[model samples]
Target: MVSLSRVPQFTYQKLVHKIGSVDVLWFQHNSLDPELLMPKALFEVEHTTDIQNSLLKFQELRWFFVKMFIVADNKRRTEFAEKMKYSAFSELRNNKRVEFVSYDQLVGQYNMVSAQPSVSLLL
Candidate 1:
């Protein structure tokens, strides 16, 4: 099972675009400025579906997220890497803005992050 945190609010297919729609858009909670309201993190999950489409969707919204995470199961992660264009994969490989994570990794991170109490609560 996948375990992602629900700590912050996110937009799901709320903001439309040409290719289709973003899977999940996570934003920072602050009143800094309207311009700063852009998503801090973008996520595309490909479990049993085509990772290509999910990747394409993230590519379309590359401007929105400061950091993007593409999630796939163990098998698909390798397959997606193999099927991707060399340049595209290189770009994905090079960009810190994008990351590819396996389901187990995600769950582990989620478990680690979510298990801790909020700083606000600690204060």
Candidate 2:
């Protein structure tokens, strides 16, 4: 279940399947019909926890259209690559169903977006 406290922007109640709790999930809602909402992306932030645990969760939800990402420290990129070589994760690796986002990359993106002026204000 997604916690409303984490995403206060969402006012409508959306249904998410029980694929275990993810660190962060982005949902796409139809503007015409707010009731129609679907998962757009899934992110797992692995700082101290085992990376394999996050991969296992992503493996189970690979069938969905949602984009999957594993966020971790840049130093762990090699660990991620090594784990992706495992036979069990062959499907995810071969198909490129998942991506890795380093903490620095994530923060950089956030900062870039924050630096941009709002379109509404510009208008």
Which candidate number maximizes TM-score? Answer: 2
Q: How many residue pairs clash in each candidate at the backbone level?
A: 0, 0
Tens-digit per-residue lDDT, 1-123, candidate 2: 255444423333232443337888776676887876566678899898988988988887777667888999999999999999989899899899888999888887776667884421110
The lDDT for every candidate, in the order shown, is: 0.59, 0.75
Off by over 4 Å in 2: 1-17, 117-123
Estimate the TM-score for candidate 1: 0.64
Indicate the residue-level lDDT of 77 in model 2. Answer: 93
Cα-based TM-score, every candidate? 0.64, 0.78
Off by over 4 Å in 1: 1-20, 34-36, 86-93, 118-123
lDDT string for model 1 (23-115, tens) is: 665555457564443355667787778777766666666555467677878777677666455465455556645667888887777766678
lDDT of 2: 0.75
Worst 10 residues of 1 by lDDT: 1-10
